[model samples]
Target: MSDQPAAAEPGRLTTREAAGRLGVKPETVYAYVSRGQLSSRRAPGGRGSTFDAAEVEALAARGARREPPLSGSDLAFRTGVTLIDPDAGHYYFRGVDATELAGRYGYEEVAEWLWTGTLRPGVRFTAPPEALEAGRRAAGALPVHSTAMDRLRAAAVAASAADPLRFDLSPDAVLRTARALIPALVGSLPAEGARDADADRLAQRLWRRLTAHEPDEGSLAVLEAALVLLIDHDLAASTLATRVAASARAHPYAVVSAGLGALEGPLHGAASGLAHRMLAEVLERGGAAPVVADHLRSGRRVPGLGHRLYRGEDPRAGALFALLDRVPAAGPALAAARDVVATTARHTDLYANVDLALAVLSVASGMRAEAGEALFAVARTAGWIAHALEEYAERPLRLRPRGQYTGPQPAQPLP
Candidate 1:
């Protein structure tokens, strides 16, 4: 909070020198100070701020870990949860490779791994019959024109209100609640008479609810892989919201509700549907070139083409796309996706991301238009739980960040 500049000393670097060390401009240097990541001091005689040389170097080292650096105005803060290495175009869940886990295990198995650091292969999520019935009633209470996510959100509130033990914040209790919540949310949607037809596996259960289509092996694989791949990433906006709620010791149900609320935003989980529409444009035009040119001319980004953390490639996209090959139904959409990615790569470094892959698979499988976003929300529920668990172990409310208070100055003392 010190505005006066630090006195020059052997161990201190001026603002300009610190900026050079971080490979950013002075404004960016100030941004770092504002985040409290780097300590700044008043310059002797009010010249300007200077920073501790060691602190600046340490931040530089952390920046190197992210390679090209995280975009979207987020600070390069550290977390013990997920490591998204853009340099290698890969991410890890608590030090283990995510793509490998997604390929080898179902979402249930991988989600358990993220939550407890051990994969529980045969473990499955199931809700009590009464709880599921309650969830369905809550979802049914929503107004017409409700999206699937809306139903999920409503179901969460109902589940929380009905549980007498919802206040428990212990790790074991949280995991127990999560175990019940995932299945409850899945079961709450409108179903085709046989609600439990594919009840043994989460993906097939969701497939029936999403499109009421009987399970196809290839399509099931695509949905399962999409779920596992989206289990966790770095602190996305939704995940951050979940953690902030957890920091206040909100119940597991409330924590997930916080995350799903953020996920509903068009810029986040809903983004996959937009990505699908963009590629549909390429199909209509018979080429990626014109679509790309038109999007650029309009000053809007070509959706789902790139990501901030993984500038080279999104590993989840690669993992999910691999499964699409066996899904012969997705053939045309896959072909169009390839054309768009290839064309975008040729023109700019922007590459296809997981959202683009999800959209393509959704289109190919003949699912509802909002199917991809639903899958994203379901998968990310695991991540929100993991983040909430981590936050629970920290001091309560530690996530409360200070504001710079640039609004109106102190109110006049008149009256």
Candidate 2:
């Protein structure tokens, strides 16, 4: 749209050359431009267009950034995991909108979607009867103060022992075992047995295990939505650890163990539970301003307040809060959550994230103080397994990074 004649800049490419670089038809190149996925400028004589060669190449390579590696600092690695647009407060699971998917589906349905890139309904995740019994026995062996995550780790070991096909790496074999692990994990929690009638629904079963009370459909729906929302986020720290293990061709159980180890850290999966502890005080104090002021004054972060990815808002938090607002039993917790957000907004630019929503769910449902963390761990298993599958399809040990030597010279080269 320039008045003067347009001339191609050095290092840029004509339309045809851009298409060739991308290995796509010229029409496809135009489509990318139309969608703002790629940028192009008018060619010489104001005729066609010349695309930025670097932009076309980056698009072709999909996330390979040209930035130099910042050792022990921020990084961005190319991945084909779930796509998130935090500026828009939305994400997609393999191209499907996560909010839409969560609205109409349950956990395993979304899990299958993440794993196979297809939405198949009525899929069930259940293990053999004896396998559940084995997990229960393993969980029961843990001490009183041990966490639900500890019980899950113990149960994972027992279930691996029970599965004779645990080592099979075939796609079908891996998926079959993955399905079985979810149910076995659900049955492993330290809670009452499931009745025959409601045993078919994974959410219902998990509710019994976590709460030790009768399952309510509304709360179950909220849990399902949470699971779907948390299913897979691209290249999270725990997911990176999971892929590293999978790159070594470790079995799914071991991959899950690696993920659990990463999730145990306070900076990752445990943040939600910590938020719950802080929010519990809000519920008791009947106000959040004092709690927020105290946290800010102490130079401590308001737990579950904001996210690095989400610039405007967190869609996961929005989705979960919408569902929780409908449950009458969630009143007190929802009130406290509202206060937390309002108070934090006045003091800082931070907003509520998925962890805050998860903490709110814990308080409302009267689940254990640590239940938020356990829920995050359980929901993220779907993502961890999906990432493992993706890693297994790639060349092994592809995640190894070149370490820059920073220490004293290594003993003068072993002289």
Candidate 3:
């Protein structure tokens, strides 16, 4: 036989050839493998990886078919509820500054205003006794190791089953459901301390479930502000899920359930828990430098330091940090959080986001790491309902988008 080596397989491409076909660096091709977006195999003699030519072509085609950047006129919906001004580093609910509303009013009052466009001073939300009982029972029945988010999901479903009028999608009915559901979601959690009086504000009631310590007025204020600040931001992932449910005319409870389902991932609602863990590590190590360094070394983002919509510090974080400054217990956690920001600032321009502020509250108050996630879910319930109401008025299923099929041809033979 001739000494010459065999030619490459007809259907395979080397790493460089694959990268060239995909119009990206060989490193990005490796990244695609790491992300499970593409597959590679060892080349003959184990010199380097080879990719299937057909797979590379398909990926390149998909990239070429990617849509252009969305404009205001493309897939935009009219909303009167919330507006975010990224340039100004501010957000508004009903055209009024969100921070102003959060500072001036309670969570219930702000929620009512967002729902009805009218504010009633001292407005309160109370769960019906029966609904609260059902929610608690369902939440309590979960496995012992179940997360707080799991209990919330269970409670939402139980609450829906208990509400016979849940199918009523009328505006008045949805408004009533919104009020009762928010409180029921809060009340379902097992209390860590003495049960709060029913007449207590929602924040006060929620405090008992989060920690055994009695809440001072300052800490309570911080919690209340956090609730109001988190009430809505603009079509967040969960809110969009809620809107899609509402567009299909699902009941308010189901809409909320959809939102809760979408809130489970770390990148969204559970982000605060990550921040809490990071801050706790910082406090334990007696400094932020080591913790930050470890995060960078491990290729993990230091959570709670950035917001896509804001150019500076998250306004919600600013509001909560201001209130936290007044509570003596928050001093150490707040300092640690500040240390994290300072330490990270040396490398990146990222500023503290609301997740960091929530972490400070949870750590200082001796609440579980999951406390911030619970606070986010309960507060954002109001926003979900508001979006539901908006979607209920729109043309049905307007949020649906057609998928572009990119798989093998339909006539392919069975394997």
Candidate 4:
């Protein structure tokens, strides 16, 4: 049998051509083959590989779609707090549609409902005078360069110290702690303007902390909706930490402390700040293309573009954006955000997540970049408490997972 070369296939593409069509390197094309994302055949001369042109185009069209990252543990806990239906592009809190709840109720009302399963209209949370004073003092003592989240952590510690009943794990005591602690967290931050009256809504008090601009009715509504939507989201990392603390019978304050600790990670609470900066840059640069290109060139995933849990737009984001549209001041920043989503969609199927919506609110309201993070921490305090209550009912220390040790054998001699 002769091994002479034959003419090239007309409908096929060489590795180089496929790379060009896919906007990637030939090496990446080979990687796709290894991962079974694409298939290739040996060329007629057996010297190189050839890909079907149709297949290459199809793979490129699929873009960056991927499965949600695994949490590395098989353990699951049953809870009635929140349900996220990714396929339906919606989430619910306690059997009620979360977006609808945000629309119809205030932050305090939703939070109260989540805690007790009873809807109390016109409910409000007030910071205890002693707890608020202690929190302010502790937060004020932090270095000048400390962030809003830093202040929140410091306040949590001091507030825990100020409460004589912090060690009480009873349901009623825990509820009292949550209500007072959330307001204390908000009050701890140095006010950016004249302090709001204690009787004001939580969103109004929080607004005073975030920006000096006077709050309009529309903007306050957006802030309230953000809080309601953020109240809980199934067991996030911080929620898990809060539950673990509760499993060990930690007091409500300490469980919240645990949650705040976990929330400080960049991949979690800090993500919105990154999105804020990105949106600002897009606005300054007068386009999303170059800013997005810079992020891609530096190998950074575009912030606020996607959520692992939602295959489409994050429901929380959708709800917030709908409200933001009514705020005239949000017009420019909102357009910038939309540009970011549209630009990224050219190469990937990602949709805007809650972080992006938060960035829009922060940017348009003249708030600092970290404002979104503070909002997340404050709102999620209620959720942490809800989970703590559930964990308190479970067997004590039930969350203690046995580690599968994969180190030196027990029989090994000490060095």
Best by lDDT: 4
Give the per-residue lDDT digits (tens) of candidate 4, residues 1-415: 1211244489888777887888875545554553345666667756456778888888888872342443664247767688889999999987789999999999999887777655668988988899999999999999999999999999999999999889887655677798999999999999997768747999999999999999999999999999999999999999999999998999988998899999999999999999999999999999999999998889999999899999999999999999999999999999999999999999889999999999999999999999999999999999898888777765588776798989987888878
- What's the TM-score of each model vs. the native? 0.78, 0.79, 0.82, 0.82
Clashing pairs in 2: none
What is the full ranking by lDDT, best candidate first?
Answer: 4, 3, 1, 2
What is the model-wide C-alpha lDDT for candidate 3?
A: 0.86
**Model 1, runs deviating above 4 Å:** 1-78, 192-194, 197-199, 413-415
What's the residue-level lDDT of 231 in candidate 2? Answer: 80
Better TM-score candidate (1, 4): 4
lDDT of 2 by residue, 180-284 (tens): 888888778866445534347777777766676565778888988988888877888899888899888988888888888898898888898888888899988
lDDT of 3 by residue, 1-415 (tens): 1111244467988777887898875545554543234666656764556778898898898892253554654247656668899998899987789999888999999888777544668878999998999999999999999888898999999999999989987655777899999889988999998877867899999999899998899999999999999999898999989988988999999999999999998999999999999999999999999999999999999999999899999999998999999999999999999999999999999999999999999999999999999999999999898777767766688787878999998899989
Which stretches of candidate 2 lie above 4 Å from their native place? Answer: 1-78, 192-199, 412-415
Judged by whole-model lDDT over C-alpha atoms, candidate 4 comes out at 0.87
Worst 10 residues of 2 by lDDT: 64-73
- The pairs that clash in candidate 3 are none
Across residues 1-415, which tens digit of lDDT does each residue of candidate 1 receive? 2333544678998877787788875545554543335656556775556788988899998982244644543334435567888999989876778888777899898777666544557668888776788899999998989989999999998888778899987555677788889989999988742557424778877877777556578888888888988888888999889988987899999999999999999888998888788777777888778987887788888778888887676899998888887887788888888888887776678888898899888777666667788888888898888777666655577676667887667776775
Each prediction's Cα lDDT score? Answer: 0.78, 0.77, 0.86, 0.87
